[model samples]
Target: MRILGIDPGLNTTGYGVLEINDRKLRLVEAGIIRSKPSGTLSERIQEIYDGVTEAIDSLKPEVLALEKLYAHYDRPTTAILMGHARGVICLAAAEHGIEVEDYAATQVKKTLTGNGRAPKTQMQLAIQHELNLANLPEPADVADALAIAFCHYCVWRGQRVANQSADP
Candidate 1:
């Protein structure tokens, strides 16, 4: 199964495409979708929509695992801004006919590092070790995206196997 993971933001959204084949994980692609603060919010969203659409087209992932929208009481605007980016990401996924699942940041972190409050460096290292990458996925967001995908794998692996067995 191919899964696309997304960590959405208005300025810099991160993406990771992972494939589960024969019980192994492979990183097909990982990158960032950047929008400069100088651009209008509308333009940034459009750029995000375009970049994500391209990824969906090129990778053709079976489903998408997206981090759920989160906000701190002190910083409400962050959630509002991210809502725009998430909208476009989901829009692109819908257009491509891919199913979407939303996971909380804590859930993803716990799945990856066994701690809901694991640090960013730990998440990066975990992803690096999981994918056997020579270098850590950069800029934190990229690693976070990969973690989201890995979380889905951990949550669904057994169900997927059972379903496959039932099919035959």
Candidate 2:
């Protein structure tokens, strides 16, 4: 199974693709989609949509995992804008016939690091070790994307195990 994880933002969206085979996970690709910093909102949205659509086409992932929206009282606007980015991403996935699964950011952190409130550096290290990468995943966003993907893998594996035990 191939999973694509996304950490969406207006300026820079991060994405990671992971392929799982017989319980082994391999990184297919990881990178960021950058919209022009000075572009209009509509232009930027279009750019993000296009970038994600391209990724979906090229990566051909079976599922897309996303971080659920979190809104802080002090920065409600940030969440609102992020909602725009997420909207286009979901649209792209739907267009490509890919299932989308979303997990809370805290849940992703806890699943990977044993702490729901793990710091960025800690999360990066955890992902690095899990993937057996030589260095920490860089720029935080990429690490976040991988964490979201890894979280889904953990949940999916657990469900599969539970089902197997229940069968006989």
Candidate 3:
């Protein structure tokens, strides 16, 4: 199975791809999709859509795991703009027939670090240890994307085990 995790943003959308073979997870790719900082809203959206579509085409992930939208009362506009990025991402996944799963930031953190409020540094370390990487996953966005992907793996593994146990 291959899973693609995304941390969406207007200026810099991050994505990570993980491939599982015989229950071992491997990092296939991880990077960010950058829209021009000065581009118009529609132009930026188009850029993000194109970039993610290209990734899906090249990487061929089976599923997309996306960070769920979170809106703060003080910064509702941030969430609204993020919704645009996420919308295009989902559209790309749907166009390619890839299932999309949403995971909350807290849930991802808790699953990876055993703490719902784990700090960014801690999360980075957890991902590094899990993947046995030589260095920390740089540029927090990439680390975040990887964390989301691993969280889905953990959840999926648990469900698979439960199903097998229930099988007659």
Candidate 4:
């Protein structure tokens, strides 16, 4: 299974694609989509939509694992903008007919690090160790995106195998 993980933001939305083969996850691609703050909100959304569409086209992931909206009391503007970015990302995934699952930040971190309150560095290190990467993915967001994909793999694969067993 190929999965695309998204970390949505108006200024710099992060995305990573990974393929799961026989329970092993391999990183295919990872990057960030940046938008100008000076642009109109609608324009920023369009940019996000376009970037995500391109990612979908390139990666052709079977599923999309997205980070759910978590309220940030210190940054109301960021939260609102991230909501818009998330909409664009979800819309693109839906248009491509990929299954979408949202995971809370805590859930993702816990899945990756064995602790919900794990720090970013710990999560990044865990991802690097799991994926067997020579170096951690840069800019933090990419690592977060990869962590999201790994989290989905851990959570969703169990359910998938259960369904298959019940089927035959």
Candidate 2 residues lying further than 4 Å off, grouped into runs, are none
In model 1, where do residues sit more than 4 Å from their true spots? 161-168
* Residue pair clashes in candidate 2: none
Per residue, candidate 4 scores C-alpha lDDT tens digits across 30-93 of: 9998888899999999998999999999889999998877889999887887888888788998
- Report the lDDT tens digits of candidate 3 across residue range 7-125: 89899998999999998989999999999989999999999999999999999999999988778789999889989999999999999999999999999999998999999999999
Choose 1 or 3, whichever is better by lDDT. Answer: 3
Q: Candidate 1: what lDDT?
A: 0.91
Q: Who is ahead in TM-score, 1 or 2? A: 2
Error of 3 at 28 (Å): 0.5
Flag clash pairs in model 4: none
In order, candidate lDDTs are: 0.91, 0.94, 0.94, 0.89
Between 3 and 4, whose lDDT is larger? 3
Ten consecutive residues with minimal summed lDDT in candidate 1? 68-77
Task: Give the Cα error of residue 101 in candidate 1, in Å.
Answer: 0.4
Q: Model 1 over residues 103-150: C-alpha lDDT tens digits?
A: 999999998889999999999999999999999999898998899999
TM-score of 1: 0.94
